[model samples]
Every structure is written in structure tokens, then in C-alpha cells.
Target: METIQRTHVTDAPPLPSPWRDAHVAVVVPTYNEAGNIAELTRRIYDLEMPGIRLIVVDDDSPDGTGALADDLAGQVNESHPGRMVVLHREAKEGIGRAYVAGMKEALARGADFVVQMDGDLSHRPEYIPRMLGTIMAAQAGLVIGSRYVPGGSLSAQWGRHRRLLSRFAGIYVNAILKLPIRDVTGGFKMWRREVLEHIGLNTVRSDGYSFQVEMNHLCEHMGQSIVEIPIHFEERRADSSKISLAVQVESMLTPFALRFGRRRRG
Candidate 1:
């Protein structure tokens, strides 16, 4: 992990940048991603969207990711002030809860839009500008950086089985839910604040990777306008994969539950 020199500020830096003026918040949920946190934060902060804030919702990673996030937040906030907010949870719950907490914080800060991404650097920060552009130009409630889209491609390093499983998951979820989205399992996404507000974050029940599918499902169910922009999906270089057998089981069960059990608009 990169070491960032800590800098302290006397007061919150003035929010006068384009990012702040637009009220854009990027919420990244993390667990044991210490190796990548600094670089990721640097890249996101380097974008320097003025008021663009990066929220790192850490699940109390034993590897000290939360502490590293604090360092990054301190360094970034020292210069940008209020541009980095790290929410350290008591224990590793799930991505769903981490996101809920971060999104709520974004909303509380009066954010107009919120972004969701993985902290392991799989989701490139370069595409953020385009995602934001698409959201505004297309007036989409949700903008997804999709691997299943025409121009999107997964890393060549991914094996056949991994590729097949990913493709199959998207196909299976879409078939069952009849969602207009092609990347039903995509994690790199941007959402208008209203979409999150309307979905009622507290009502979302998925506690594992299924959270991604469930969020997509709710957006489709609520008749929200969504746009998918093709993106290059890179494989993570550090830390063990979080996906496990239990998460896979939940991913499978989520489709059936959402399609049959859930009746509300979410």
C-alpha cells in the first residue's frame, strides 16, 4: 500500500469546486482492500471535481483498510476539505449495508448524485466523467458501466469458466426478471439521488453480492430510466476474492425472491 503523508486542516476546506457545485458523491464500499485504497483514492481525488467527495465505507477490515482510508481521507481532506469521508463499520457485514450507510451519508450531505464502485480498482476512475456525462445528457436515473454492453469487454486474463459464469449470471437474472438492463450484475454505477431516495434504501434486504442484482431489479421495477455505457472490466490485482459459495447461493436465490416474493415497487 502507498503511504500518504497526513495533513491536518484548521477547518473544512471551502466547497467551491465543480464537483461540490454539482453535489456529486462517489461511495465505494470496501473490505480488506488496503493495498489498493491509496492509489484508488489518489486517482479519484486527482480527478479533482472541485466538490466531488469520495466516501469509503469500510467494514472494519482486519487488514487495517479502515485505517488506511482514514489516512487517505485525512490527506485528501487536508487539501480539498470535505472531499473524503470514511465510514468505518464495526464489523464486516456485507456490501449492501456498507452501501446503504455511504449513500445515506451522501444524501445527508446534499448530494445530487451518488456513485457505487468497488475499491479494488476493478472499476476505473477514468470512466467516471463519461458516466456523469451520460447521466446528465441522457437524463438517466441510473447509469451503469456495463461489461455486457457492446463496447464493454472483460480482461483477457479471465478464464473461460469465469467469463461463462459472469455471462450466464446476467442472462439468468435478465431472463427471470425481464429487466431492460443487460448488465444486471454490474457494480460500477451512478445513481441520481432521487432514485436512491425513491427506492428506500432501508427496504433493500440483500446482504451479499445479491445486493447488486437487487438494486438493479428495484430500479427496473420502479420504471426508472437507466442507461448502460460500455466499460472495460479489469480483474483485481490484490486481496483475495470476496465471492464465495454462500454469496453465489444468495445471488441465485435473489432472482426468485425478487421476481416472486417481492410485490412492492422498492
Candidate 2:
């Protein structure tokens, strides 16, 4: 494992309370996760962590995932009250764009910390408390639920070829970008609001799998403290994998584009 140098955000805005009093925003980007949306939100709300809010950014799925998300939000907020929100985008843009919109909304609503996770059950809600704990304990700028980290494991259902490809992708990206983080392409992550501010979300252009790489690259380029915790990544509870050949090609080509960018120092 490469050692990532940690740095602090100077003149940073006030951060939320570690676990209590902090306004935590969870951004769930959905495409066609209709089958899993209800359960996903229910589990998140069941955590019953005070100051927890869920923002479901739906990209207008033809399968009515957006409508289902709205229904779930309404049902959950009835008891929890203002704890869940749904942002319905006009059309499918990309996961990266949805996240940018959701994060911006969270910030606008005065969220102290923002988390990004898949709407599918693959990114378990059970590990959220642990992720928050890791960020606070390490005082990290970002905390990633990493599959490539020590103690992390992938789903047994994955075939050898899929596993090999994932490992190879990680190794290839690491060599090109030289990021100290183990799972650079992993989607499950939490960010301190200041890190997003420092990295300039508007500058991120990746629209697919490479989005994770772009965000990780920005964090490394800015010398932000990133902590990766072991997460057992399981297969999606519903829906097939969305990784297309175009996405794979984009992932393969992104590192070279980022290799020459100047690191932002403040």
C-alpha cells in the first residue's frame, strides 16, 4: 500500500458534530433501482441516526424508479419528518452528474457531511455507521468503503474473470495515477463538505465508471486526507450490472487525461 500524505483544509467551514448534532446527508443516485429503492431507504431510516437525511437523485428511470423513490420518501418522512428527499432529474445523464446535483443540494441545505452511495443494495447501509466512525476517528477529508483494502472482500458470486479484471483495473489505475488509495474506482464514499469545496465539483467531467477515478484523483491532487475502510461488496440485490464496454473503455482511458493536471495547493 502506498502512503498517502494527509493535509488539513485551512479556513474550513464549521464541520458537523462527529455523530451527534451533525447534519448528515446521504446522496443515493438511482437509475432503475425500483425493486431495491424501498428497502434501501427503509434500512437507512431504520439506522435512526439523528441528523440523518437521504437525498435520492433519480434520473427519470423509465421503470418508474423515480416515482417509487418519491413514494418511499413520502412514507419515510411521515414518521421521521424531513429526513428524506427525492430529486427527480429530467433524464438520464450520468451517475457523476446526479451526484454533483445531489451534493450541491445537500450543501445548499446546510449538510455538514455528505455521503454518496448506490441506490442498489450493493452499497450496504449497515456499514454507514462504521464509515462515519472511520472519518471521525482518522480526521479524514474523505472515507471510502474500499473493496481492495485489508479485510475487505468481494461477493463470492463473482466469477474469476470479473475478479481478475477488477484487480487488474485497480493495479493499472494505481500505476498511472499513483494514488495512495487502494480502491480508487469504488463508488461508496463519504466526504467532508470542505473537501468538495476544495476540489471544485464543477471541474469534474467523468460521466461513468471513471467518475470514481476522477473524484479520487482530485482528492489526491489536492493533498486531502483519505481513509479507506474495508467493505464487503456484494452483488446488487436486483437489476443486472450496468457496467458497459464504453464505461470500461472510459475507465481505461481516464488516467492518462488526469496524469498531467497540476495539484491544487492552498
For each of the candidates, give the backbone clash count: 3, 0
Residue 50 miss distance in model 1 (angstroms):
1.0
Could you tell me how far off, in angstroms, the CA of residue 72 lies in candidate 1 after the best superposition? Answer: 1.3
Angstrom error of the Cα, residue 211, model 2: value is 0.9
| Candidate 1 structure, TM-score to reference | 0.91
By summed lDDT, the worst window of 10 consecutive residues in model 2 runs over: 1-10
> Which candidate should be chosen as best, given lDDT against the real structure?
1
Model 2 C-alpha lDDT per residue in residues 1-266, reported as the tens digit of each score: 11112233232233345564468899999988888887787667655367889999999888899888877777767777878889999987778889999998888888878999998898887677777777877989999999988899999988999889888889999999889988888999999999988787777877787889999988877888999998899888878877788777888888987897553333
Worst 10 residues of 1 by lDDT: 6-15
